[model samples]
Target: MKGRGQESFVSLPRFAARLYNALTHTQAIERQHREIARDLVARLARGRLLDIGTGPGRLLSLVHELNPELELFGLDISEAMVHLARKNLAGLNVNLQRGDIRSSGFPDDFFEMVTCTGSFYLWDGSEECLEEIFRILKRGHSAYLFETYQDFDESAVQKALKANLQQESLVRRLVTPRLLMSQLRMTYRTNEISDIIKRTAFADSYTLDPTSLGGPPAWLRIRSTKPAARA
Candidate 1:
């Protein structure tokens, strides 16, 4: 993230577009990333899905693999992201909303499936975000959370903190997922992300095997369900 190549264009308005271009433009690297996205989106297949932190709506296309009738929606805080997503998915019957997942304007039980990938770990509170996920999902709804887990060793994280990526810029040296999770005091093991869901409004939750996301990345994908009201 040093040179003006891809790092300089990320100035709020062009941030999302830059993010999308960086991932999609890389030929040798992008296919693996897309395949990983494909797997995560497919596993949470359900009607009326919502994508959180959907950077440029690339993964939203994966819904095509599921029942064609399935509906899709996405939310992102970046205007550039919104514009790109709208343009990229114009022909499809999908809804693209510009909003924050933490304070989403949607009503309760609005969707059957909710997905937040490649961006959930950037948020401030893991618990609060989980609550918001539960609130917006319908009874018996399922949510898929994709994020980075802090590793045990300190060197692995210290290396990512000094990057110049948008969220991981130099000014924010400790911006890597490892440092971010540690700063947030999130001590849950990778396996415990699911259990964290069950302790909330969701009644059941479980972890899937480490999915092959096809990138030089280590991401955690956890699925959970919101149960019907207790008697």
Candidate 2:
């Protein structure tokens, strides 16, 4: 399962990358996630912000637009995705890199805010990745992780697909209910996600906010913070 999940991102073809960017542009759920992430970064982000698994860099671009003064960076495991993101974010005052989240190699207390969306479920070493995120984040700052649950709204997904693939019958046929369900199986439940957070450095310093994400019940956002040093 881990190998398959890793392959899904690492081997993303250029055509598939274009399709993903188009879907995010047209899909309602994807749009909402981007909007929420942008708003959160705009409000809470200061100094430097890093976005993990920033496929195509749409959310990072949005956040940069909202907070033009913010220093933004993006990392993705997929070289293809990073290429696409670099193209999408060209001349936007953003830094894009290709790397694994488990070993980001950034300095400690680096970013004021961090975010990961839609790709958290693909992480095979989630605990290590969370710990890496915790390490890079400045003390008292936060990282937000967004993922879809097993019971995520099927209707919205179908609607989003239909809206995005209106002219591509073959694409619509490929995105079947069975395929969606199978993909959902790769994701962790809300409690399971919380448990993963508890095992990380952010244990005892995180919030599982099911209501804050503002989408389907199965859509969850985990806000985890690194504590400030004792005085």
Candidate 3:
């Protein structure tokens, strides 16, 4: 968690890594990952994919299940998270590494698509991170970012709550709402996110997607592209 004026980047601690891994396994969280995976899988036929802040690497693992041929990579600032991602992604061809997004070590124009979910809010150097994303992403390709928003669509929240009430897991029904409320207070609004991206090289090349799933319509799914090379 990072405050508005925080100067330091915060990585989840080892203990928090364990707890987060467990929480992501719950039915509600799994559903969220699946929605993201399905969308990503449907968009591209084949290319390299990078998941920044790949906590526990569950989303990459789910993506792999749908499309085994796609080259998958996961990066996180937390060594514990990288270790857990490697463990969870075992037996799969996915690559997992520990690195910060402010200045990722990947080569320029490398990845076909990049994704960061639920992690963009914690970045203290968002502009730097977006610049790095632009640098590593191939021209004409896109990066998908999903972050929590403070002013989420109220009707969507009620719909999500109703869906959760029908779920069998007691924890999902009770704990998810509380978690959502806490995250809403800590995260950005769509306009704030828009402003940040506008300050980066990706300015004029991003759009917001309305379709998202998880706890509610609280997730802002922004797709930003590196402009294609002209002939």
Candidate 4:
């Protein structure tokens, strides 16, 4: 079991692993998303908190720093990411694991809160993943899904462009347009994400909040819950 997990980690592309933090770190919008996620977890997370796609575990680390009493667990598919996350979260009692969200090995009703940020589009099995999340969450508790879309509102695109121009260095500023274009190519539409959510076990058990992260209008949040009693 451990070897299988480690194998996946070992196969992570070096550049992808290395570039993950740098790309997210310099962006104003990325920082806003991370802050919003951390705040959400701090306010609502109790008992065990599991953060999926916890690349470098940055957001989890921030949440732990703010609310030291909450237990933290992080799961990511990349070995290099887990390694960096371990180092980033060293001294904290965080359980960092390498795994896929569609088939996490945790027991049913285990986690009090679950969070996935900035990685939903990478998931190939969105329905399965949501089902897995629903299975693991304690009844009456919820999972938070935060994603940024490519096809954002016009106002959001303008705000993001202005923020990038102001905050990034001159060289980095020149790259913003290209990067944003690439992101748009890869991102899913808001309706596409919502449709995936509606198709899962969490159908009719979730709420969508667009632009709540206060950055790009492209940022959307979904709060999905497991019913207190199975019908």
Q: What is the per-residue lDDT of model 4 for residues 1-231, given as tens digits with 9 covering 90 to 100?
A: 222133434478767777756665666755665677566765574688899989888778778766777888999887789888898889999999988887999999999898877766777677888999999999999898777676677675766677756867876666655665675667788788778888988988998777646455666777898989867
lDDT of 1 by residue, 88-118 (tens): 7788888898776668888888888888765
Cα TM-score of candidate 4: 0.86
Cα error of candidate 1 at position 56, Å: 0.8
* Structure candidate 4, residue pairs in collision: 9-79
**Model 2 C-alpha lDDT per residue in residues 33-137, reported as the tens digit of each score:** 656766676567469888889998878887877778889999999988999999999889898999998899899899988887778888878899898998899
Error of 3 at 188 (Å): 0.9
Decoy 3 TM-score against native: 0.90
lDDT of candidate model 3 versus the reference? 0.83
What does candidate 1 score in Cα RMSD to the true structure? 8.0
Looking at model 3, the pairs that clash are none
lDDT of 3 by residue, 70-177 (tens): 999999888888888888888999888888888889999999999988888877789999999999999999999987787788777868766865764777566667
Alpha carbon lDDT at 71, candidate 4: 86
Score every model by TM-score. 0.67, 0.84, 0.90, 0.86
Worst 10 residues of 2 by lDDT: 210-219
Model 2 spans > 4 angstroms off: 1-4, 27-30, 151-182, 211-215
lDDT of each: 0.61, 0.76, 0.83, 0.77
Error of 1 at 101 (Å): 0.8
Instruction: Give each model's clash number.
Output: 0, 0, 0, 1
Residue 159 displacement in candidate 1 (angstroms): 17
- Residue 147 error, candidate 3, Å: 1.6
